[model samples]
Target: MRLYKYYRPDFYFEKSLRYDEIFFASNEQLNDPHDLVIKPYFGNNKEAWKSILKSNAPFDTWCLSKIVDIDNDNLTRELNDEFEGVVVDDSSSISSVLDNQSASLAQIFEKYLTPQCNAMFKKPEAASAACVQFLKEKLARGWDKRYYSCSFSKNPLEPQMWAHYGGGFRGCVLIYRGLSDGSINLRNNIYISDSQNFKFADVNYQDKDKLVDILDLNSRVNIIEQNLLNKSSFWSHEKEMRLLLSESFGSIRVSIASGMPKSTKTQIFHHAPDAIEGVIFGSNCSESYKEKITSMLAEKYSFLLPAGVPAFLTFDSRLTSQGKVEINYGAKCIIREVRSSQVIKEILENERLNTMLKELGIPQFN
Candidate 1:
């Protein structure tokens, strides 16, 4: 359950190490325009549509209840007139259904249905279309609700990740140890979710578009999966996972002009220093940035030392003679090197990592 975030050697990278924070971007700010977009399919699942109409669900609270508030008698008359000649197998429930009807259906129709789905309701002999309209509207409600997320990868040594996210080996990767429950510790200011408001899901890659069949039970049940967890196969190489924060929960808020659309943009979230395992500097990473990382880890070393956690070792990547990348603990860069606190104290004393540690006052390992 280790996660890695990639960053270029820039202000953001320095800020993250200094403040122990990460940023979550809204869908609008994400690299992929199509990300989090769902194309709903309203197919021939009559039974699914019927279940939605019959169940006392969220739809009943928002869609049906809103319709019912619009003048109950009018709703009853309109429903009866629309279905009058149509033959229903169970005529007994029809009266109850009529009594439950409310308000001018036209108002709710205009408020909910998109232009395409609205057209479906305008056709004659489209009683089933009405149900499809409502079901699609309910399923698509997630689109309007904003979600903020930061992405990570299961693989830390992926070359593509280095090239794409690491500014072509000039950047660095921050590795974190998961909590006891194997969850990432991401907090916004002082607000942290004990696993209730925040969520983590591995991204699922598919060759086709991320489609949600509105009439399918599985599709309707896993709405979050359909919208957030799914990604195009083109992204499979990254082995991505996401940490999601809901708009109602996270600390970041956006204020837009009255007529402009709302946006969350980028949000900063803090992580516990102890949660950080270490950092890996890309092959082409500059010495200046490395110094910055050293300074930050030096501060965190005191906190990590007391818990008997492994020393916060630095790693560097190299291209082997065989033309493949490898991590090694050669006199230069060590990979996952664990040493006793005394050994670490001695190592720092020797300044084995050049003058950077000595300059940063890292010898205070105690």
Candidate 2:
């Protein structure tokens, strides 16, 4: 199981220091005998296990091999000259490349690696835990009353519940409990629904305080769950209003709903008295219906003392062939009415409009 190793003689320098006099003959000089041994573990002899005693003899002699190459002055001079030229060339090349490489490395480190490393080192989990504990402690002392109190349950269908009572407060909070094995169970049990129902048994009022503390702890857990879903984005008022209205009252179908109300028919004239540019109402009606509508328009227009006031309106009975009406008021007025139920359905289904109304501070009638 032992791995291969490449140990340079330099590694033994420190250990050999104590035996400098015997090994090197002088402290200032490093003229010690050099020995290089290559142990092959792959041949027929290598496959056979050798006794420690048999290997010890060669090992000892290998450690003290004479440094004949070092003592050769001519060979040493040639080697020195070659090495000196190589060293100078390497030094120049390295120096030239160092500035460019260092700058590139610094940019990469700052742009990519540093932020990741810093974030990795941050104690986020510990910080979150600490925050939860602090909130619990504060709540126990009755320091923060603005928060809702809730309780936790062990049921898979009901893990956490929050309770709130009137004074504009009354709802249950619930959370799914995440299991250690990466599975989750929706334990919808009330964490806290009503504060009044909770009991504090201690005579010193401390028992009641503990209930508050528990509520705070549950709130923290719920917050963590919310963070996972939303990432701290601001809530869209329009979206929330749409959900609230649509869930309760249902969508308004537009394709089938009748055209503008009869009241709107008359009001259009009053709003734009001069808008008499070929306006028509009703479809496949008798001449009597057309005459009645014409008369009504004439009477309404009689008050228009000024003529040619940009009156632009058009209508076509042919438009109703598709179960819908198309009324065109040139550049000023446009009105349409449909006979199918889908017209109303579209209006009802338009949650965005509903939400926009709510965001505009409109009060819900139902």
Candidate 3:
């Protein structure tokens, strides 16, 4: 069986450069081209090289060093000539010397670069053609009917055999199996899993336009997921917290209160009927009290609410001897000392709050 190997660019370059540099340096001694070995660095090995390079040298420098052999006298002189030529060629233009250096480096790498150094490292022999072909045909049928067995045992097929049929089939099969067992969820519309990891969306059968659209959507989803994850590790912690909080609290109530005028609140509710089950315009509140309410609302809903939700503003009233103005939402009650016009606008327009209203199965609008 013929074995095929895949390496990430960094790994390929790292090994290729190390081998290429050693080969170039050796060639300087022996004046002959030595055949370099190409090996497939798979799984953990690929990641290991990245960790090494990240801690040692910056990745680009390490790869470039192998190609250029900057210390070599002949190569160095050639680079110098190229740099001087680029400088003179664009002397009248506004281009800086940095551009010349970049062009010179490109030329040097083109002439002297060798195949990857790690190409010498061999990947394991894959399954033969006969072994993987059946599996591939089976998986192409779609996930629901793909597998006959539910046992998590590995099929005796070899990797090379699967590769011969086509790449990614085996991985897809494993993924499908995972999805079936509830170990994984296949979110077809989004290329990323709920866990925020990427899946190689099917591209081979898609036409150019459809493929481009899918890729673009996937890229957007990835960016949004990454931003959410970075800003707050909230989603990751949410599941555990939900379980814990569920045990302690019989009900979770989300309160939407604003010091804004009743008209603005009515407008927001008209637009974002999904944000809250009910909106309450506090009759009277102080500036400090209103600020506190706005801050709390922003904290709870800022990450939870999707984009397009407007900001709430402070209302015109001030707190009297009553200390707090109270309004009752079906799920929770809110108290505040001041309300703003903008705050009412935001409360009425938020879709998430509207969705919360639906979830409660609340039939009447107060």
Candidate 4:
């Protein structure tokens, strides 16, 4: 899993300058990089984009940060870099699906069922009409075969990340944050179980060129707005939410996304979720910070917690002598089946037994 995390130059520089700053807590201005709104810098306006890029100087910086590398010496090496979404556009996940037939991602799995999928097919397939036509016929028959199980990310609030890139693209991007914890960085493993979060159109769009087209700004914005505006999608989302609680156990994800209403005359938006799964805090986090967040979640989002929603907290000096940390995402609950409470029980015992006895001043008894 060679995952690369993207960071704006300014965010990266700030992290470097203040190594222990807990940057996620700060109220400084932050943009949804993938769906940013920099005035005339909207859509594919090349001149405005160029100006924004020039202002950003080194542009965006991506780092080779793997869970394995988090504790290694190489993690400290700072990178200086451009194209906030260059790596994302060139992602092999996106390319492989189009190139590999086994993926079957070329087909629209469903129609008008999802406004996002409908708007995608409505686009002119310019450079790859053959692929588009094939998809249209395949989808017209109401193809229901699973086209993909992949990751996608966007402004969880405004999903325009791929609007200009031929629309109906989906995957969990490297960055995602709820309004509650929107400050977490690329180091976090942001995964999405698309089973309920998204529906890939059953159309196979093979022309990478067409998929990469810089669409009209208005068109791109409209596609995103349509996704939000799809009242049917929200109904489906509500059903999925109820079904998730009824059918799932162990780990899950709960996301609060910004949705558009069904009316074209009004622009009011509301918050909803795509669900949540196993989540762990970054090792750089402070204990007090952890407590504050846990308290907030318990108070405001208690309904989201399942039988055992796990929390992975970084250790304070009181826990160990050397501060060595082992990120336990291998049991991420997504990749492998997490069957029991053994892992959680073990963690609690390791973190509490000795402290309990010492604090109570109990005699060592066999």
Q: Write the per-residue lDDT of candidate 2 for residues 46-67, one digit (tens) a residue.
A: 1111111112222222211121
Candidate maximizing lDDT: 1
Q: Which ten residues in a row have the lowest lDDT in candidate 4?
A: 249-258
**Candidate 4 accuracy as TM-score:** 0.21
Number of the predicted model whose TM-score against the real structure is largest:
1
lDDT of each: 0.54, 0.21, 0.23, 0.23
Candidate 1 deviant stretches above 4 angstroms: 46-144, 190-199, 217-219, 248-266, 303-310, 321-323, 330-366
- Which ranges in model 4 have alpha carbons more than 4 Å from their true place? 1-197, 200-274, 300-366
lDDT per residue (tens digit) for residues 232-307 in model 1: 7888878888887655311111111111134544478777766676677887887787766765666545445555
Q: How far is candidate 1 from the true structure (C-alpha RMSD, Å)?
A: 12.0
Each candidate structure's TM-score, on Cα atoms with residue i matched to residue i, is 0.61, 0.15, 0.16, 0.21
Clash count of each predicted structure = 3, 42, 39, 27
Task: Estimate, for each residue in 220-260, the C-alpha lDDT of model 3 and write its tens digit.
Answer: 33432222112122222111100000001100010011011
| Stretches of model 3 off by over 4 angstroms after superposition | 1-105, 108-224, 232-276, 280-366
Poorest lDDT segment (10 consecutive residues) of candidate 3: 241-250
Task: Quote the positional error of residue 294 for candidate 2 in Å.
Answer: 1.6
User: What is the model-wide C-alpha lDDT for candidate 4?
Assistant: 0.23
Under the 3 Å rule for N, CA and C atoms, how many clashes does model 4 have? 27
